[model samples]
Target: MSQIPMFRESFQHASKELLHWFPGHMAKGLRVMQQKLRSMDGIIEVHDARIPFSGRNPLFEDRLASVRPHLFVLNKIDLADMSRKDEIVSRLKYEGVTEVILTNLKNGQDKASKEIVSKMIDMIKSGTRFDRAMTSPSSYNLLVIGIPNVGKSSLINRIRTVHTKREGKAAPVGAEPGVTRAVQQGILVNIKPKVYILDSPGIAQPRVNNVVEGMKLALCNIIHDHKVGIDIVADFLLFYMNKAADFRYVKAFNLDNPTDKIMEVLVKIAVDQNIYHKVKPVTGGPWMEKLNLEQAAYFMVRKFRSGELGKICLDSDQLPTHTTATLSRQRARSR
Candidate 1:
């Protein structure tokens, strides 16, 4: 009989400093966003669905969202685990989030994407600033904001296509973080209510809370892979999957079995993918051919991002077992 091997119970990284990534553009963008806040009727803050409870910029909540009708659009729903969707929504609601929507912007015609404009308009009309919005009844201005690479630009383009029936992209988009360097002028989307959305650059927190949080951000590509080392990012992903008992990678990468060692996995990936580079020996002899583990690490992380492994929620552990409403009812019943 064969025995199952034990995996890591937790992940560890040497440096947490690699997680802090607030560049000059982010600071400048924050200032520009604040300047434009007075003109916006509402806020649509986009975030990665896989990381509903992680990597969100607190400054948005403290400075921008509180002053307007804010809606959290968790983008990339296609790649997230929806099994706990109810718990996620309930927890967000308990945390004082008035509105939340899960969406996959890649599908321009997705039901959630189609409903965004209407949802924002409804929120603006029913909010404390409805009278202010009424003053400009012909049009509503909204700002799309969030940490980098969570699809803020993509959302604007999707919304434009849905509302205006436009074929071309209204805002620029890229797979990498910090694609949009500054706030741009509003692009008109709806003709009836006259919706205009201003796309803003992704803003990350100046200091990350911890190394694990940083790794999560890196895994989502919110931070550059090199900042935290691609190898470390891949290692953390392995640990996370193993801890959750997810072994899809074994089949995905053609591994004989699951193992806690990242080097072994990367070596296998490198060999299987034919990723190699020439290396010079320290003894001043001839250069030798070696497997490129760095490239292999990147490939592994990319697979996870592309949903080849399976649906996953990085914040699944953070969700409350009992919702606030349930706890209240329980307390009342006990009395």
Candidate 2:
């Protein structure tokens, strides 16, 4: 019988520029979001559940969240493994985050999405409204904020559907980041307590400090695919899967066996799909056509995002107090 190949312990991209993707629109959006924060009653920050521990913009907390009632929602819970939800929540609490919610924002009927409005009402009622409290207003205004492509728009649309039974999208949703360019004017989502929400563009940090953190964002598709080459992203995905000891991709991609070489894998994908590109010889010889490795890499990355390989939590391997306690109990029983 053939033995399984050894997997990689870590991933390193060829070009480690650190995936800093702050576009011009984000700069303007941040300014606009802060300007509208004074009239806002509460703030909701959305983030991808796959990489809950990293890739968050610290500027949101420093500039907008301090004065407002902040709610952190880890969206896309269906795409993430929630077995360690308590551990994830515990880590956030330690970092001074008291209000956090796990939600599948794409689903309008989800209980968590419905609870968002109620939670916002509770937070606003319990918290001070700053100088705006001088005027007794019957309605509440909320600002939805987060990093790129984390589903801020999708959440707003879902909430709007849940409460108002709205037939259409209140905000534009896209797979790519920065879909919402500017801070949208007040959008009515609930009528009972009179709630209005402002949707803001997804802003990224000026710099990504860690390479792994950048890779996580790229893999989760928070960063644009072209900025960080698809090959590099796919390579990191393969390395990450192998590091986690998951080989679901081998069968998904129809590979004979697992291999650490990214080009080898992309070549197979290209051959299987008949994807190719024309290339001229460097020596000025006849133009040579070759397999489109970049396209193949992108295909592989897309499949992973669509959950074709299998269900996975990119950050689930992170062990915390909850995991340690379980490990301790198991050890005791084994002894």
Candidate 3:
């Protein structure tokens, strides 16, 4: 653990305002999802396994989840420290989550792919199919939902490849958040059980109530980097790395000790890795190359997201123990 007294006690954003990042597409996608609930047999709510608790939209619980059989899939497990997964799952179950799944969702077939397909089929077999009334189809229709860039598309593609005998992406995938701009329907993943998935645009809350949660989401690439500001995200990454006592970054970037200051780290990364920016004055001066801190921070954040800095769980120390609604209210009140 970071020595609390040695490092900064808390992270404070300069804005001191709520981080609200709902775009036009998210609002429209949500409306589309609520209308499609009657068509869904089950729900697979994907989240970053590193942030098992943060960045989930409580509105999803209120508007869409109540009427469906829900399964929470915490994705990106390859980049998370699962030492406390039992505690995480138990706490989620305590909050009345029907089921929780941990997934790695990589380029090739993995155990998680098969497990997700099997479990969803089982949930459809056993759990209630809400608003579909008495009649149900032989194949299952599952809706995939989560905050942005938590690997929802990757999960669907993995299941499709492993179970459906398909060879390519059924849904679009990208490195940045908000790549999924629309709610697409009937992405088939299985032929034997006749399973199909509906991929929805990732939705964030209108306002992120807590700054720490917002920082964590930004660090995990769930929020757009530009929207959160790369410097702030890098600072949070430094803070959490110290808090977790994960010094892999020190070796990764050839630093002597852990840093709480992101600027120093970013500059060092730029110097060591030769990252720079070309600038030309509006007055028509010659172009000059300068060490770019933002680019370096982006590089560092990518390292964390890609697991190059080492396996870290940004949310393990801060999992929400209370129900989603209760925590939402508490966070709102604090704001």
Candidate 4:
């Protein structure tokens, strides 16, 4: 029988500065969101499902969630391990989140995507702030907010397509972070009991919690790859997957076996895929062809993001082993 390979128990990196990413646009976006808060009846905060427990901007809860009925849409569920979804929802509920929905916004016909409109309408009607909304009974305005590249714009566009049957995108969508720079004007989504959604820029917390947390965000493309270093991010991905006993990347990257060293994997990927660059020697000799480790790193990370590697949940370890009710019962029994 083939023995299982052992991997690193923990991840180590040189500096935490790579994880810190708070641009000028993020600050401006926060101010604009605060200004528009009073006009909104409810909030829909979208996030990446893979890192459900990581990288959430706490400011959203302190400044926005407290005043309004907030619904969390964990987008990109297609790329996440749905088996642990119940635990994720339970943990979120414990953290004061009243409503949570797992969705894949890329699919226009997705059931969860279709449910968002009705869900928001219901939350608005049932909320204590409904009387304030009655002043403008015909329309319900909701603000879409979350950290960068969690598909805030995509969620708005998907909802618009579902309710209004409009094929054109109301908000621009991009694969990279910082796509939406400022709060956009409300776009009409539903006709009767008219519903309009305000698309706000993705706001990331100025400081990340820790290196591992930042790595999760970086791996999910919430933070720019260059900021955290692509090679370093790829290493974290390998470390995370290995610790989870997931070796799907070995097949995805065409490696003979699972190994902990990221450089070995990158070298193999570069050689097998013919990803190389011409480098000039310091001695001024002829240009030498060397493997492009950077390109290889990007290719590896992109595959994971696109769900080519496999469906994974970065916060699987953080999920509660027992339900909140069960834990409460155990505590009561102990007492």
Top candidate, metric lDDT: 1
Model 1 stretches astray by more than 4 angstroms: 132-136, 321-335
Please give the RMSD to the true structure for each candidate, in Å.
6.0, 4.2, 6.8, 5.8
Candidate 2's clash total is: 0
Models 1 onward score TM values of 0.91, 0.88, 0.87, 0.92
Each model's C-alpha lDDT?
A: 0.87, 0.82, 0.80, 0.85
Write the number of the candidate with greater lDDT, choosing between 1 and 3: 1
Q: Which residue pairs collide, candidate 4? A: none
lDDT of 1 by residue, 1-335 (tens): 12448987767784655656898999999999999999999999999999988878889988999999999998999999877898888887876688999899767568998898999988998887679635559989999999999998888888887777887878999999999998999999898979999999999989888777788899999998777889999999999877665677887888887789999999999999999999999989999999999999999999999998878888877875656764464334322
Prediction 1 global C-alpha lDDT: 0.87
**Local error of candidate 4 at residue 22 (angstroms):** 1.4
lDDT of 3 by residue, 180-288 (tens): 8998977989887688899999998888768888888888887777777888888888887766545677778887666778888999999999999999978897998
| Model 4 C-alpha lDDT per residue in residues 65-85, reported as the tens digit of each score | 879999999999989987767
- lDDT value for candidate 4? 0.85
Q: Which residue segments of model 3 deviate by more than 4 Å?
A: 1-5, 14-18, 128-136, 280-287, 319-335
